[model samples]
Target: METVKRVLVTPEAKKVIDQLSKQHGKLMFHQSGGCCDGSSPMCFKEGTFRIGSSDVRLGEIAGCPFYMSRSQFEYWKHTQLTVDVVKGRGASFSLEIPLGVRFVIRSRLFTEEEFARLEPIQNG
Candidate 1:
């Protein structure tokens, strides 16, 4: 059976991830819940941003692990998140900000079949 991914990345976002990875080495992503960046996805160097047990590991995008706070996950659990890049600087510390772009999440609700085959989530 084909596994359904909880998180995905667009080609444009992948290019940005590759560029950032080349400079920063390993990278990871966190879905911010309406704080510094308004519900935007933040990128960080792996092991830099602290991931606590309260966070949920959605999946990987561009070889980097993606996560969300457990509280936030409660609301987004039924949706598949797509990491997309936009052409504007965001007011956050995400790596992409310096490059005049920010990582944003585009989500879609999963169908019953897709939900049934979703990849298992992990506790951070």
Candidate 2:
């Protein structure tokens, strides 16, 4: 994928990434944005992030690794964030943060149909 911001995925997410890497040969990160808040870094199976035109670059967070678009990196530069995994019931990836920050949960990456449903909220 294109280079973007550098971000870190939590250790909980590492297990999933390890599995995905096995299945897909490897896994990388990619994040986008929401309207009201700053750009949200997310994980992508395999994608492109062009700097300048883009914003984020792939990197590590806390200790775990993730991808961030170039724009997102610059926008979120010097910002400290929390990343964790929430399981049980309908388990989800939670980007523990202050108001206005967001991250793409794992479920949304599965399909465009499902992603579209949440697009309004993410984009709004």
Q: Cα-based RMSD of the predictions, in order?
A: 0.6, 14.4
- Tell me the spans in candidate 1 whose CA falls farther than 4 Å from its real position: none
lDDT by residue for model 1 (1-124), tens: 9999999999999999999999999999999999678999999999999999899999999999999999999999899999999999999999999898998999999999999999999999
Best by TM-score: 1
Structural similarity to truth (TM-score) of each candidate = 0.98, 0.44
Error of 2 at 93 (Å): 13
- Candidate 2 structure quality by residue, lDDT tens digits, 1-124: 2222223356675655565456555344444455543334444344332334444333454333454445554554444344444443222132222222234333212233432332111110
